[model samples]
Target: MSFFFAALCRTLSPRKEEDVAEDYLSRDAELKVKSQTALHNSHDSVKLIKFADDTTLIGLISNNDESAYRREVDRLVSWCSGNNLELNAQKTVEMIVDFRKSTVPPPPPSVMDSPITSVESFRFLGTTITQDLKWEPTISSLIKKAQQRMYFLRQLRKAKLPAQMLVQFYTAIIESILTSSITVWFAGATVRDKQRLQRIVRSAEEVIGRSLPSLQDLVDSAFYGRANSLTCAGGKSPAEVANTACSHADALNVFRHRCNGKKTCELNSPVFEQDPCSDTFKYMETSYSCVPATHRVVCEHSMAYLNCAAGKVIKVLGADFGRRDHTTCAFRRQKSEVEKIDCTNDAPFVAEKCDGKNTCELRASQAVVGDSCSNTSLYLEYAYICTDA
Candidate 1:
């Protein structure tokens, strides 16, 4: 019976595999057909690029005509409806990259009867691009993201993880985020911006308990070394050399291959659908040069009471909710005794409760953030950064 069952399974496996392949092919063909039809239905002047479900439509207008842009948006909305794909209005934004000086203001474009919000800076494919083509926003975002990952690095260090393994984790988690689209944007970055990025690397080096070369130094060495047929002479291993080679080649090749001649192009990170480098450690970075957009920055100091002001949202960047030697935002039970709650992981909860509101009052209590520890007194401690809604 066991022999007969084994033989039966073998006989059925090929047919099942063929059926699965046929199903996948049919679904792929159907998706392609729908996507093509959507593109075909769009205005002739509008350019569309579809990757999976993400679609971007680009339209060129002279002297702010905007008629062609609106028509394309309306057509796209209709197409999506026909194909059962609902257009997400909240995610839809319009950015006009106009370099030419004009006496009159440009007309605003609308989609699906709603006015599309115009943004000075918007994130596309992990890179923050501004209309005026400055790298400051991207750099700021990168630093902010890297700082969060540094928390994990600190945790690992405290746990006394192996140095080699910590380095691997840093490269995989922290470094990857910092360099996601470096190739696209690194050239346009200002000196100060580069210095700011290097500072983060320096912090990483400190965390790993080893000194590594600055990002600029690495880039320069990679570029110069590749230009000259020279091997990087050091105690460096083959893996290090290969990593540097891939990083060097990636930036130059991406710029030369993708953005060299194009007047206007969408430079997406993860440049190719497939891995371009054979080494598992190597990945693509992307950024673009564009015109600067108009924005305002407001700075304020928050002491015991924190307010987000009007038309702004509060984002808690980092927080340490515990008792300290100093008296800051103290929660007192008796005159001598103080109560505190460590609610580090309750960031999301606080955000959910307080974000989008004009003001919020926080009470450090078990009810608010649950009792993390008993007997030892504690207080709520946090730091927040606010941004315009």
Candidate 2:
């Protein structure tokens, strides 16, 4: 293809653009393409010809009508040097040698960064990424990132009070070296382990995959009414899961302070607590909502939440929306079937009675337990990040 294109282009020019392009372009790729173009500002008589090498040449000859074909012929004659345009086969070798000898690639241009006028100090490129964001680990951005993480955790807490050990969240990694001093500052977290950190990372990945379902998954799961059940932050026991989540959150806060960043205060909110809400339920098969990834925990029955009494979800303790009736339950009731809800209400659904017909069509598989021992898929993604800094 290279030979073909070059040959084609060569036949179009007495002196191919490739031969003069480097010199005119200063060996810059952007300039190379630009220099090779026949960018005429206005219509004019121009010399356009093909060469034996199949290279094309286009050049301004004359704009005047009188000089039309004459100017083009003159340009070609000049390209031929002393030789005539109608050259016989005998002089072809001599003409080729002359053209090759005259052609040489242009040198690359010299580019320098902003000049250093002062010898004493230099203005370095700002280490701060003032532009976009990265989905992976990096050194500089910490607090901005931590707060982003905190926002996500809070959202999980709002949706799933007793979020499972593997509830997912966005993550970022910082070098431990930057935070080693900070971990020591926290007396309790001195015995950190690398393997433990890896486990935490795996947990975080599961959480993200669940929350943000891809476009294809969203279409297949939502529009098609397919059962892609995945529970993130919901688990067999809320108490055990909350404890594990807190440890990871605490480790991240420690990592930040060591980097001379803001010290995140201890959180006593239900977000970091075991038994965060008044009620508990054994999760059946949990499917995602809204998007393919937003987790929707499906309890087996409309039985009152362990935390509810008098037909109302208890309020003294934080009330979560799970474990309610299939229709007209507290959460759904607040919507009035069509009205807008100012605050989230407890939402539950009643499944058609189970007569051993296996009517429960929840896709339950990953890490299952509880009365759901027979139905497996009760699993949630864990989203997290750690920095050595």
Candidate 3:
């Protein structure tokens, strides 16, 4: 009995239910009355309640399996065997397995949960109607609705629409529709029964894959109705926007998340790397930061320590007292080439008495008068600092 209500709720409430019937079916009061009677009879006493845009399917399941949340849904079929339960094979899915498979990449929003009202419509008598009035949502029901819309969206792309338009259409629609990548596999089987529909979906997928358009680029065409200073062409609803991008809410969420990580993003030439974001793991040993000069190492405090192999700072020098020459040509040098007659006419047989800003003193050593120098260019060349000592 409970299982019957579950199916019953789906059929009775069209608001929560999405259109599953892609087929252009008939509309007439006679068929609807008959169908409604048949469906109501099968479900027994199940009361349905409605909200503004949402409908709640409230029915008690008599089956212990359902109340226990067991795996089997077949018990309902046993109860309604005599009626037309018209269960499409494509609609059903292994919920747990599917969810698990879907977690890696976020699942696309299910069509069954569509905030949109009415899908596959029907007409009973003079009134035009839609199927949302007929169904309840469970994961199973949603999958089926998704499949149907998947087919419809594909058809739009394949129409004589221009390629650019098609690209825009799929970008917005598919992004909203394709919540998970794996949904494609299910989509394939959804319309396998109809070759035409299958072709539509395949084409949509092809368009979606090749273009990879996001919903970010669109201009609102409709004016603010005839109320204000709005004189424009035909007015279209939000839905009429056709290939409008993903829902604003979802797009904003993703945008905010990426924005929060702005510092981590390697944008422009300025990059802020986290500690463990290295490749060869060699630099991970000690703290050395890469400087912009030649393959040189700089400490975290923007001080150059040692030149790097690749001319770009590879290793980050740590707090140790390491030193590096300035980034550019600091001191200049002149190259000396051996000239034949240079020393022959030179007065340098005697070491020229050195006089500069600083003077050098001769030490009592066994060598020439080169022992001690003040500023000590030549003498300091051999002088070992305490650091080196």
RMSD of each: 25.4, 27.5, 28.6
Q: Where does model 2 exceed 4 Å of error? A: 1-140, 170-389
- TM-score of each model, paired residue for residue: 0.46, 0.15, 0.19
Q: Write the per-residue lDDT of candidate 3 for residues 30-148, one digit (tens) a residue.
A: 22211223222223333333333222223344422233222122333332232333333223222111112222321221223322121243222212222222212222333354466
Candidate 2 lowest-lDDT run of ten? 1-10
Residue 73, model 1: Cα distance from true site in angstroms: 2.3
Q: Which stretches of candidate 1 lie over 4 Å from their true place?
A: 1-46, 63-67, 217-389
lDDT by residue (1-389, candidate 2, tens digit) is 00000001112233444555766577654532222233221225332434333222222222223234334433433443322122222211100111133433222111121111211111112122111221112222333344345555556655754434224233223212223222222222223333233333344445433443322232222111111233334444554333321122242222222111112112222322333223322122211212111122333242321221233321111112212222323353434432321112221111111112222223222223222222221221111112121
lDDT of 1 by residue, 243-335 (tens): 444334345454444333234333444544344344424433334433222111111112234467678776543332343332434344453
Between candidates 1 and 2, which one is better according to lDDT? 1
The clash count for each model shown is: 14, 45, 29
Question: Which model, 1 or 2, shows the larger TM-score?
Answer: 1
